[model samples]
Target chain A: MLITRVKKKDAILSLCKGKTLLIACFGCKEVHFEEKEYQALKEDLKTSNLNISGEIQLDYLCNDDYTNKRFELHKKEIDEAETIIIFSCGVGVQTFAGLIPGKTVLSGCDTYVLPGFSGFTPSSHDCEQCGECMLGFTVGICPVTACSKGLLNGQCGGAKKGKCEVSKNKDCGWERIYNRMTVLKKDDLTLKKMIRVRNYNK
Target chain B: MHFTELTKMGKFVITSELGPPKGFHIEKALHEAELVWPHVHAINVTDNQSSVMRLSGLAMCKVLKDKNIEPVFQVTCRDRNRLALQSDILSAALFGIDNLLLLTGDHTTLGDHKDAKPVFDLDSVSLAYMVKHLEEGKDLAGNALDGEPPKFCKGAVVSPCAEPLEPQLFKMEKKIKAGIQFFQTQAVYEADKFEKFMKRVKEFGVPVYVGIVVLKSVGMARFMNENVAGINVPDNIIEELKKDKEKTKSGQTGIEISARLIKELKPLCQGVHLMPLGWDDKVPEILKLSGIIAEKG
Candidate 1:
């Protein structure tokens, strides 16, 4: 599988933390990675006092059966694992529950919101799983997600220049939207003209 | 309307989940919810499911109500003290999301933000009681409401096959006393196990909508077997999938098993809750396979 080695350090640190075993199933495809980048990433983890007691394991599942087998082999151990960290792109993370049976499993995509993930902190407000996500329609950025200020309709004047008024490092929600629009070739639609999205469930 | 009314009519009550995003855009959250409108009987917007960040469940439920779908605004005490908890419940009613699901959410440490503090003011059972009190024109402190209290068809959760069925049964009894009119359980895998579990609790006379999580692949089946609590996947079924691993026919198998379970459990429960797990489009097929129609009523 071609594995891309960007942020290889984080991957290495993740494998080394708070758990006995770290199993990486890259799924059916190869993630592209430059060999040099992979080694350096590995070295960073080693320097950070990662115990490399043969606890870290990586696997490539080219076929579905192997995927099933890998889980079955570690099912018991995984269930008993203090913590199971899954790093798959697809919904495979949701399915992992059946194999190990009993352990806390957290999706990696969600992990990026942690305090350590640079400046991404969860907003003080809670998300009521309202069955709607209004990001794409609102200039390709979800006010609830990308915007730290939580202004449903527009940028919180607090977001000065391009930085969040809440934090200097975080990109203001509007700036992020602007950047996304530029990338998607839809920058012509500015936040000023953005209309309030009506209740979707209604 | 009381859940029994829908049950007596033999309606196929569909429920869907709205997973809140990890941060602050209410507009995006509402728009995403708009996708399943008019399809589900009630949309369950989770309250900090797994303790991850998202838009407020009450806010989302309010948004869902604006869309005219009955919102099951789930409330968990994992992040709030009783004072804030009671306030949010009132806020939910004020916002017009009538239904509420009480939960002791997953620990904060388990979520994306580990540094976040957790506030477990009360477990789900207590929350259920508080809801009942509010419905009875009384506050949590036993004070009377100024006007006629809001009536809620309160619901709580039950896992039929948890190792010690007695604890779950015990909790259910407490919930029943607390005025919980309906129940939706965790995912159901073993039909016979669930049947046996149901026998013990059916006497409560509350209608339970069996949770049928749609399995997309064997990988998913394996994952569920490995991680989720109070759930078990039969080895025979797993082995069967392995034998036909190359066929890529698990989706069909999933539908068949779900349909079979529904057919078997149909007589035992008031309804079935299809947790399509993002495969919402396939729910119709599974329902059809189980001889369930939308009723168009």
Candidate 2:
């Protein structure tokens, strides 16, 4: 999932209290880091006694060409700030780090690789990005991400009422996988553990 | 007899699990499988159940096969990549191991090998697809086999009682599309809920074997409730076990409870898969209580 949570808000403010540049990509809407979170962050920064040089909402900071274009447009602000703070996913943060060598860069959010629904909003469903897609066979469920145990073959001994043993808040991923297969009239495809080994690169 | 034959003859299928030992000590597991004979249509030799290192499901399946025991060999995506999986599948078929159960194995974090890199090369769904490809005489890459392709009585898993049930429902449908022949579900304690879920499952008309793990005690049920993912033991069952532990012998109570569950589930599903969870000997007794004959005199 893209930047699910932000960390070290005070640490960010302390470092960029004066003459600091802020670059954010709260895009990707629902799944990625949202703009409302950054808006709240801006409100917090106003009371922190910081000399804000300028803020750049780098559109799709993960893209190199677009980032460069934005960089060219914000050269004056870049020159004025003493430090750079990023509030996008790790990819966007890395892009800025590579773009600005001399400047001290700070990450505003921590990115999680586990997928969330819709690339932008955090939906209950997730994808493991295991390369081989099983949703076609599993009735659109992703066991790699859904099951806490990630059991490829069957349900664990610990599952209770179709909820996962590890976390009560989360539904048992396998339970959902089975029910989905049943509804789709594909339960026969599940008799044998079909796992032939996944090609991670795929 | 093969599970297919048993089900075809209208015999309510009964299957149980045999966990391979942590080391290569296969004697105990082999012995256990033999002892469970006649009662169960086949024995599911687990592949590293609970992510704990054990003899591979295929190796144990071979061991069981040598003894003429039908083994449901388990395969998981947590350890191997595609080539290794394909090679092993062929090997299992060569050894006459026909039954298989695919899984997205538990995360390596839950096992003793937590530090080892986990290889979730495929989820259970993709694995099911791979099996279908093999059955069609072609590899996942579309390469046709030189001779007759291997045949297997494929079994997939389902956890019926999980909440927010839509995703599991969808995945079950996909598995059918992928060509799974049968389904053995996760541990289920509540028959009413399972029946309700089956009401929806009936839409597909698949043979679904309800999973039943013998509950030993209140602590065991509570631990499962607290630690495991994707299964919940209702409080009433827990309360029954608690009373059993506090006031009577838990072993007898567990048998009664599990047998009661099986009896209730008999008419609702195709079969029952009993996972003793190390309580292998109790399986026969549990079966007996549920009116399941252990042997044909």
Top lDDT prediction, candidate number: 2
Q: What is the lDDT of residue A10 in candidate 1?
A: 51
Candidate 1 on A1-202: residue-level lDDT in tens?
A: 2222233345335423354344444433323324454445445655777653322244432233545677676666665555454443212333443233334343322111112223211222222222233332333234554555233443322333355544557766655544444444532332333333224232
RMSD for each model, in Å, please?
21.0, 13.7
Q: How well is each residue in A54-105 modelled by candidate 2, as lDDT tens digits? A: 8888666766677878899999998778667777665566556556654556
Clashes of each: 53, 76
True contacts kept of each: 0.00, 0.32
C-alpha positional error of residue B20 in candidate 2 after TM-score superposition, expressed in Å:
0.5
DockQ of every candidate structure: 0.01, 0.16
Displacement of residue B17 (Cα, Å) in model 2 is: 0.6
lDDT of 1 by residue, B187-248 (tens): 78788888898888867788898888876677777876655655667887676556655443
Residue A144 lDDT (model 2): 58
**Mind giving the per-residue lDDT tens digits that candidate 2 earns over B161-219?**
76656556656776776777789998888888899999998988788999998887777
Cα deviation at B15, candidate 2, in Å, is: 0.5
